[model samples]
Target: MSPTHTDVPMAPAELDPCGMPDHPDCGIRDVLDRVGDKWSVLVVVELASGPRRFGELQRAVDGISQRMLTLTVRRLERDGLVTRTVYPTVPAQVDYRLTDTGASLTHLVKALADWSLRHREAIAASRHLYDQTHPDHDIR
Candidate 1:
């Protein structure tokens, strides 16, 4: 039987943690459109090190608001990419870890990061040139 939404895996809520929606035209461009945000990439990288508590993840990711983090975690969990474990304690604690599926995407994320780092200067130069050519427009 074909999977329904409930039967389908979930991704982190805040972002498209599974990368993108399933469809015939779900090309790489579509996947990028879904989870290509800077925040999503950073979160994945941070989670790759190991499981982390909500606060820890927030701190690790940098500049992510609490709401955003919560949403992101939810999406990841729904997508079946991230697993959440809650431990009962004096104040209750929750940790998030990447599932095997999520871990599989780490290499792609890392490669993207590496490529960005390598081409940052060139990208900056391109932006500068574009700005100079079109003073009234910001093409970045």
Candidate 2:
């Protein structure tokens, strides 16, 4: 038997837990890892409306520390999902806006957010029951 592709030996398109192809160097996984974090989702949604400065994003993304925001945008920039621009001003203003790829991802993000909202109460109840049944451990 031979591997399907030899680019990354022993790594071929295989289903992951999420049903996405599980393989080393899989671009899908690479993209998901970059934008699948909660911070990434929130950041992308916040910028979906338009570009925002660092402080604006910090405020828009509740509970996100400035440091985490910095890291998130940096990752997005590296992924080509967002653009970070600096302008010469009194304080050298910085702004972030979604790239075409990032804009394309907003619909997916919104769908996931909507699903979470729709199932919030059910999920809460499930969590409560699970916690009661497994008091000795944290499922999270």
Candidate 3:
């Protein structure tokens, strides 16, 4: 008889105090490092709408340099989150679009953006209070 699903042993759900796995090869940590980057998040959000050309992405992302955008998209493509297509035009146009996995992450990204907009004022106030309380400790 074949072993049932429940009969299979499972690895312990071990995590540190911060809720992250203690192992260096943790998949969650790798993904978070990729998507949690400021440039990656912005690029993914822009691609969420539809396919866009290299110049369009550079402009829409605001303050991202050409080299940085190139590196960011390459990383996203390597991770299977984005696709790059080249058109056989005189200038050789290139476009970027999110894969299904990347699209799925958009919802969470939008929620985080909304939350930031909502609490920005409160966060600024908190920062001011902290600065006032810790004048000597303020780095800036």
Per-residue CA lDDT of model 2 for 1-140, tens digit only, reads: 24432122232334234344554444665567768988999999999999999999999999998667877887788778999999999979999999999999999999999999999999999999999999998569
Name the lDDT of candidate 3. 0.85
Two-way lDDT contest, 1 vs 2, winner:
2
Ranking by TM-score: 3, 2, 1
Residues 54-110 of candidate 1: C-alpha lDDT, one tens digit per residue: 889999887998777876777677667789998989788889999998899899999
Candidate 2 deviant stretches above 4 angstroms = 1-24
Runs of candidate 1 exceeding 4 Å displacement = 1-34
Runs of candidate 3 with Cα error greater than 4 angstroms are 1-25
Candidate 2 displacement at residue 19 in angstroms: 13
Question: TM-score for every candidate vs. truth?
Answer: 0.76, 0.80, 0.81
**C-alpha lDDT (0 to 100) for residue 11 of candidate 2:** 28
lDDT accuracy of residue 111 in candidate 2: 98
Instruction: Report the lDDT of model 1 for residue 83.
Output: 96
Against the hidden true structure, what lDDT does model 2 obtain?
0.84
